[model samples]
Structures are given as structure tokens and as C-alpha cells.
Target: MHFLLSMFPSSIHPHLHPHPHPTTFCCRNAVLEDLLEGGTPKPLKTGTTIAGVVFKSGVVLGADTRATSSEVVANKTCTKIHHITPNIYCCGAGTAADTQKTTDLLSSNLSIFSLNSGRKPRVLMAVNILQDMLYRYRGQIGAHLILGGVDCTGHHLYTVGPHGSMSKVPYLAMGSGDLAALGILEDRFKPDMELEEAQLLVRDSIHAGIMSDLGSGNNIDMCVITAQGVEYIRPYQESEYSDQRRRKYKHHPGTTGVLEEEVVPLKLEVVEETVQRMDTL
Candidate 1:
């Protein structure tokens, strides 16, 4: 025992020393404290629904008109469809500013390219430029877009992601409410659809998104691109949800008896004023 005590400190003697109890402090509270000091994190308000599809002779693009800031609706009628060229149009999602600036930049670049080449820019050309720009930024640009157009090659439809990923499809959808919209598109879409059928499909898809997502509402905008020409519709359809007052709950005067009535009269006092002049040298 003496030898063991001499080898190890008396306070740490194996047999005599008590094992330390596990700490009762919670690590979660510490993390919460640190987060609280920094203030509650705000939810990102980037919400939209944009989609596109290719038909027999043309392509149709659709989008919702609601812009949100957190839980607040910022713009009820904001345009998500952007013009890339006479024949090319884009429907954008994600950050509104990013999509707007990105499409604007692409439009300007395509316009300049057309001027230099003396021919209208191709859909593939626009896709390439957009993918390259987004790739260089490494997904920092929050622009999810659907590019559709009619060119000499044929009608084209492509979905572009913020990370520079691109896909060519007969139909595509993007944004917070994309799942709902895509559900409708996948169910009704068919090969070689007529122009009217394609328009209705696109409209119904957007309506589904609006009905499903609070962030996607207000109205629907569409653009049709064909070899003949382009038709840009500001509001192809209006929202079915409207504020309607069923009945007015107005009450006539003296509907309720006055518990007690009191009236006070105002008193006014008038004072006469005299003007005096002072002489100065």
C-alpha cells in the first residue's frame, strides 16, 4: 500500500479515488446560445414556378407571377419570362435578381453575336453561353432557367441549373413548386401535341403549381415560339382565387343602445390686438 501510494499521488490512489461523474451539461444549449447571439436565421425567400415544353411545331414556356421575401409576397405580378431573341424565350426561377440579370446578360450577348454573325443566334448557342457563364461562377449564380425556342435546327427545349448543369427534354419544370407542376406535365404531355393542346397543358401545369404552392400564385404568363413568329402573353390566365365578400356585416346607426351619452361643447376666447411702431435712427 505504501509503495502504491508512493508511486501515485495520494489524491489519485486507484482504490481510494472516486471515478469522475459524467458531465451533466448539455452541448445543445451551448450551440443554441451561440446561434441566438447571432440572431435567428431568416428563411430564404427565393420561390417561383417556371416550366417549358416542346410541341410538333413550336415550344411553350410558362411561369407564375408571384415573388416572395420570406413569408411576405413581394410582387404579385412579376414577369419571369425573358426574351433572349426574336425566336428564343426563357422562363427563369430562383433568385429574381440573379435570373433577371443573367437573362439580360445573355440577351445582350446573343444580340451582339447576331449582329456580328449577321444571323439570328441559335438556341444551342444561347445554352452554351449560359452554361459557361454559370459554370464559371460555380453555382454562385442562383439562376434556374428553362430555355425554349424555334430555330433552323428545330424547336428546342432545355432546362439549365445554377451549377451549370443542362438537360434537353420535351418538357421540363423548375422552382419550389416544380414537383406539382411536373406531375401535371408528365400526366398530360404527349409527343407531337397540337399548339392549342400544348398551351392548355402549360396553363394547367402552372395552375397546379399555384394551387399547390403559396409562393407560386397571382397569375400565369406564357410565351410561344414558332418558326412563323413569337407570341408573348403578359397574362395568359388569371388566378381563380379572388377576394369575394359573401355578405356585408354593416350595422345601422343606433343598432346598439347607448349606455350613456355625454356631449361637451367647445369654448372659444377672442382677444383684441394693438399694433405699435418703433422709430429707428
Candidate 2:
């Protein structure tokens, strides 16, 4: 009878099975695993423009506040510039907290080692550090950074993306409005642009971005970082530039017509024929 009972499986067999309990430890800092898989959604704020120009003097970095969430304006005068090293500056446009944390980590790490090293960090070293930090918390949270500075040689600029992708250029911009701003900058930029010209280029680039990106706004804050020191130009209203562009490109299609002298005006019959062919196609 005991042998027959042993051969039969019991309903409570799972309880009789041996299992080990999990050991938990005190978590000293915020763990990414919890934030990602613990069912807690992260809060975020959005809006910013990152534009920079490399001139004979050095690099000029520009960022605007005018952040917007769901087409609603959020904050004005939100800063995006951080001093990674004495000569290097990092500016970004994206999640405000993540970007700020990137700067904070860099600053804290540098300060802790400054006494022993006795040397200011370089832009490349700072960038590698930032890239690794960003790589950790990379999902759905990242910053578009523009790192600019003067090394021992001269002015330099680099655009860095979320996944540690970076590229060097004489000038660089990153944001939703980059395409529009690039159109304006491409036409205006010279190889070795001077300080005054660089200022105008930066302003014009921001102005272009303002027209295209609803999230970017407010008066333009232009900064000149050269061999001398950092100079923050007074903010100027964008409306002034909008009015000027309106005057330049303003055209009345139905009324107050202005025709290009270079093109001979086509008659109504010619226009009708072209429309007929387009319709057929």
C-alpha cells in the first residue's frame, strides 16, 4: 500500500519541492533596471535649439529657452550651456533633466580629480565621459549636444547625437530646426568667418530656427567665446527679423503683383494650356 501511494503524484507536490528565497540588498543609488522595468514612467520636459559657429576667435554657442510641450509653451530662459572644462562648453537641445545630469556628472567628476590632475580636462576626454554616461540611460532619453571650444590650435565644433555618434565641422547645429537653420547658415558662412560676421550668422541661424521650430522662441541670446572671455550679447526680439523677412519675401499673389524682370510674363492662354497638360498627366 505504501509503494502504491508513492507511485501516485500528490496535488501538493509543488509545496514539497525545494526552492531558494531571493536575497535583497540595500540599493545605494538609483538603478536603471528599476526605472526601466519597474513600471514607473519617467517625467520629461522638451524644447531647445543648439547652434554653434567656429570663428577665427573661437566657437560661439547659442541656446534659447522657449520650451514647449504639446504646442503649449513651458519655460522661458532655460539654460543649456555647461562648462565641461575651462575652455570647453557643451550645449544641448532635448530632455532638460537628462542634459543637465550629463553636465552635472561631468562637472562633479572633473572637480573630484582636479586637485590631483592639476590640469583642465580636454573636450575629447569630456565627450568620451559624456558618451558613456549617456549610453547607460539611453532609451527614450537623450540629448543632442554641440561641443565647441578652442584647443591649442584654434576654434573647433562637434555635433554629438544620442548614441555617441559625433562629427566635427567648422560650424554645427542640432535640433528640430536644424534643417531650416542650415539653409540660412550655408548661404552666409565663410571659411574663416570673423567675429562680427559670426555673430550675424548665429543670429540669422537662430532666426531661421525660430520660424521653423515652434518649441524654440524668445529673444535671441548670442554669446561670443573667444581668446578674451565669454560675452553674452543682449537678447533681441525675433519679431524685428520676421518683419524684415516679410518685407523681403512678402508677395501678393492676387493683388499688388510684382513680376520678375528676368522672366517674360506668360499670357492667360499659355497658363491654361500648361494647367490642361498637368491635369492630363
Candidate 3:
């Protein structure tokens, strides 16, 4: 894999220099960090929120839909939990272009491997391939992915970072919002979490991240993967979420979810204002 990264010239931007080395993938699609002559870019806001949790039944992956370019929220509804195959899905974080390309690379390789091997590759196999691919690009590509699925090996979850680091974890969160999301998962995640509970847990975790992190929100999308296959839980609208807040405070006041305070647990009454505002809708 190192040999592949070595193949590219040291130059991060292949297009601007017209170097002897063949064009890098980054050349075709420019990265946000590129210093274009005199124009200074707002510190590349690749902030995103992606969470993956492993349970006895299956894996649950979730991400927020806000994509930022500098100060601009580029897309309000970008899909981050990408379908790699029927049994495989990846949660993309970091730079949007790199994440998209990385998933494409993984999906394409898995397809080709399945065609040649006469069988679908397992989750670990896919992770191994992706680790190698990421290793090859290593420092050149800034992308992060939380790969999860139910292969023949049962449920598996892996996080791959641009540094080419791979770690098998039961639950993880990545992106600028990860610090906030990780706090929730650390406090409540369990080995025996049910599918429905896991879905709600992930949703709540994403909300905390979005609430506290500068580049994490707008909407939420979740991908639940079990032996039955993948099921997408659509985005929760602001109105619907506010309504949920009221119900949660009425039904279960102490539990985690949208009602939880951003940094600490607050009185459920704090949400009453938002609930009142929602009445107009």
C-alpha cells in the first residue's frame, strides 16, 4: 500500500504544477485545503457527524446531513451512510469528496472480488481491503469512514481514518462532532442493545453532536443493518423532533435523546420553550 502512495509525486495538488507524475485522484477533484495562489480559504470545514454501534442483533450506523464548505453549508441533506453492498454499508466523514471516492473504491473492489471469487466478501474482508486502499493514499487523502455490516461472520464494525488506521470497535463516532457524540455513546451503550433502542440511541447521539458542533446538523439519517438487510430511518424534521421532545419529557424525563442537555443533563423543562414554539406549526 505504501508503494501506491509513493507512486504519486510529493505534490498534493497534481493539477496546478503539471508534474511528470500521473494525475492523482485529488487532481481531478480538488480538496478544500488547497492553497489556490493568493485566495485564503476559511479553515477547511470538513466537519461531519457519523456514529456506528454494534449490538447482539446487528449494527446501527447514523450520520447528520449537513455538509460545509468554508463558512457555507454546502448541502443540507447529503447522504453520509452510503450503501456499499446489500450487506455492507459505510458511514462517511471527513472531506466529502474523499469519503465518496473511498466508498466508491471499496464498493467497486468488493464487486470485482465477488465476481471473481464466486462469493460475496465478508465484512472483515471488505475492511481489510479498505484499510489497504486507505493506507495507499495515507496522508494524501483526508477521509474517514465507519464501516459496519452483518456478513457471514455476524455483525462487524470498523473505523478507517486517513492515517490508514483501522480499529475494530463496538461503537464509535468520527468528525468534528465526534467529541460530543462519543460522550453519549460512552455513557449508555451496551453489548445487548436492541435494534430499536440502538436506533434511538444513535439518533440522540447525533442530535447532541449537531447541537454542540459547528458543522454537524440540519437533519439526521440512520442505517440499521441486520441479517434481514439494511433499513433506512429517514431524517427527522425540526417540527417532528420538537414534538418528540415533548413526548420524551412527558414519558421518560431522565433518559438520553434530544431532551438531554448539550453538555450536561438539564431539567426537561428546558425543552418546553421549543415545544411551545412548535405549537405554531
Give the candidate number with the greatest lDDT: 1
Clashing pairs for predicted structure model 2, backbone only: none
In model 3, the runs with Cα more than 4 Å from the true position are: 1-43, 236-281
Q: Against the unseen true structure, what C-alpha lDDT does each candidate score? A: 0.85, 0.67, 0.80
Superposition error at 159 for model 3 (Å): 0.6
Which pairs in model 3 have colliding backbones?
Answer: none
Model 3, span 188-252: residue lDDT tens: 99898988789888988998899888888888898888998788877743413432343434556
lDDT of 1 by residue, 1-281 (tens): 12323344344443242331122113322443464694544447677888898999999999999999888999999999998999999999988888999999999999999899999988999999999888765565679999999889999999889989999999988999899999999999999999999999999998888888888999899999999999999899988778979888999999999999899998989999999998896
Q: By how many angstroms RMSD does model 3 differ from the true structure?
A: 18.0
lDDT of 1: 0.85
Higher-lDDT candidate of 1 and 3: 1
Candidates, ranked, lDDT = 1, 3, 2
Better of 2 and 3 by lDDT: 3
Off by over 4 Å in 1: 1-43, 244-281
Best by TM-score: 1
Pick by lDDT: 1 or 2, better one:
1
Error of 3 at 213 (Å): 1.1
- lDDT of candidate 1 at residue 104, scale 0 to 100: 97
